[model samples]
Target chain A: MTQGMSLIVKTITRLVTSFITLFGIYIVLYGHVSPGGGFAGGVILSAGMILLLLAFGREQTMKIISHSALVIWDSAGALAFLTVAVVGYLAGDFFINFLSTGEPYRLASAGTIPLSNMAIGAKVGAGLFGVFLALAIFRPGRHQEEE
Target chain B: MDPFMLLLLALLAFMIIGSLIAAETEDLLSSVVCVGAIGAGLAIIDLFLGAPDLAITQVVVEILCVAILIRVVLNRKDETHRTHKDTFAVGSVLLFLGVLLVLGGWAMTTLHPFGEPLLAGDQPGVAQQYLTNGLQDTGAANYVMAVLLDYRAYDTLGEATVIFVSIIGAYVILRQRGKLRHDTGNESDS
Candidate 1:
């Protein structure tokens, strides 16, 4: 139901959405060394997508990332996380720390934690955006009810 | 009181006032903006309380919530105007809310004072162990991430599954062209 906004708002959105996405990636990757992890980062990423949906209109955004592709990403993220758990189970425990615990504070140190963060980030971002898209598409009572 | 205490109190008061305004606003778009302000206040309070992760999440959520609510409300039918007022219903609801707030305030008094965490007393709970040895065990600087993904990875997996299912549920509920449409019902056009 959303249409492209005024020139000023669209220009501002184009400039800011990429920065929001970049910060989300930083938060997800450096979650072990800093505060935000997969969940917060993923939500931010979806918020960036929502911004795009608002600024450029829903049809154009859907062209970039289709519904089927998003669903695939959502399932893939969940599967990847479960795969990490099963790997630990192969090492004789449910969720044991099976990998090398490198020096703390380093980017590549947090054994399975960072990997989990990435998987969770992928899933949460995709899933939330997909939900938003579905709801937006089904929105009722707009003046332009053209299918 | 200390400056931090005063600042936190001020932020809480701002959030309370914002919520009241959001609820009372007739225009849905203005109400969404008011709720966004309350969210901004909550994020600042989280920062002051030393929860950077929560603050970041809250700010992003504030943006997303405001965006979505604005989208939903803008160019929509006007549903706020009412033909009649039900004073008794309004009075009972206000009375109920007041009683709940008093009970919540009294319950907050029973909890430990600020900045004093209640560990499992002398024995020191698993949480104490996590804080003490999390870095050595998980090799992560942030213990919160370590706890979420390493010590309790199964829980995260379960949460991911739940999210995936809920997303699917939303799609099923919102899809317009999938199955039979009950055009005969209250729906004018399906």
Candidate 2:
């Protein structure tokens, strides 16, 4: 199978991946004040990773981010989000805002929203990457002939 | 009509044409590209309708969908020509389209005018209330975020759970397939 694209594609991928990832992080962090949120940002981040996989080949990308590690990250993100919501129950309601609201439009404002967005961003990013990885790695007929 | 309305109408027309081309195209790659074009058109329409958040989400989702679809198509063989054709298929499709057009026309007639708030009286509606109070109550400048993560947090949690469950479901199904493959490989080796 063809490993990946040409050298030019790989170089472009290397140059753009970091910028894409940084933009995704910015979207997630400033979701409360921006047009994007966890879902969009997460997809963008995974798109960056997918671009890297396409340009660098699955083997090299896996060396950077193993499948098992992605699974753990995905699970941890979901659990963290759940924990944040469950903790809100302590404030007299399920999924309530418990923390004090600071100045509006500030990063520190919005209480637990930013944290939730981060958790969701991580979960979505890792989950999407995992799906792509699984689909790419699964070779249905590769073992059939040998078997 | 005004320039904005004219532009929006053009976009809608383009979207309709794009969808038609995507459906009619025999080449899978061209179909995928047409679908991406339609999605981008829809996003632009959403932006014109003053929903920047929706536009952003739509564009990103479109990119992901196109990528995954291209990957799937790349591995699969091109569709073969059909030797047998059913006479009733085209008739049924046209009938369905006619019914959809009728229903859509009726729905459009029943809807409130575009850009008009639904609230009738001087008292503010729920959406207006949210916009006014979102910043003070949730400390979020974006009213959409305030509503999603604060006012309607329970619903947001449900959405999160749904995503998590879906991921787990995909993982389990794939892992099972992997295990079956492994078992068969081992047996063949033995």
Candidate 3:
């Protein structure tokens, strides 16, 4: 029931996939200096993955990232984000930026925020991809009926 | 009316037409496309309102949504049954719309003026503090990001947790098995 898209779409997707992924990474990394942040960038990242999933089909996409790995990545991203927050407790605050903040507007600035953003980006990207996979595939009922 | 207001009105009319098309169309594909059009229109409106972040998010989210919805209808015939118009249902809907319109008009009249700050209520100093001292405090060039990731971090944590929880919920609901075949019951996951 599931298959890759048309040739035109596949060709275009091949050209556009890397750009989307890079743009998403840029958004997440430069969040403190730009209009986007963790959530927005993460959503964009997932959008890219979803694009590949749609164009290449579930079997091929699964080859890139298996179902269980996605689950672990999703949970791990969330855990890393939470760890960032928890780490601040050593400095006597719930979410303190304990790390030394670099010069403003610099790529490596914003204390602990950049790490948090990357963590969130990973969590959101993986979580949404997993959700899409669950919805688009793994149809037990349909498989049984086909049998 | 000012050019901004006029342009906004035009976009609003476009969005309304798109919505109507989506609602009235029998072809589910066209209906989904109309919804995408509406989303694109709304993103343009967001740009007019001076929120590029929101506009960007809206555009990408709309792309994702349109793709998913198109996949749902692709390669599938429209087997949905059509129901004839029911006067009673139509009347009830119209009555509800009337009530909603009246309430919306009242709320608009009482709401903040156009181009004015919507959330600068009694505690206007909060946003002012963020705009002024956000850089020194958080070293973030973007005041919005500073507020979100530094000043209001607990809220961000809550949001991330909520996303995780919801994703877990979806995973649980979409699980195809109460227990996997050829697997012992000893494997446990929460």
Give the winner by DockQ.
1
DockQ of 1: 0.63
| Model 1 chain B worst lDDT run, 10 consecutive residues | B181-190
Report the Cα lDDT for residue B157, model 3. Answer: 91
Instruction: Determine the TM-score of chain B of model 2.
Output: 0.81
Per-residue CA lDDT of model 1 for B87-116, tens digit only, reads 998899999999999999999999988876
Per-model TM values vs. the true structure: 0.86, 0.89, 0.86
Across A41-120, the per-residue lDDT of candidate 3 in tens digits comes to 88888888898998999888887887788899899999998898899987879899998878999989989999998999
- For model 2, residues B78-137, the per-residue Cα lDDT tens digits are 677866767799889999999999999999999888777687436778877887778889
lDDT string, candidate 2, A96-136, tens digits:
88888788888889888888889889999999888888767
lDDT of 1: 0.85
Question: Where is the poorest 10-residue window by lDDT in model 2 chain A?
Answer: A138-147
Candidate whose TM-score is highest: 2
Candidate 2 vs. true structure, TM-score: 0.89
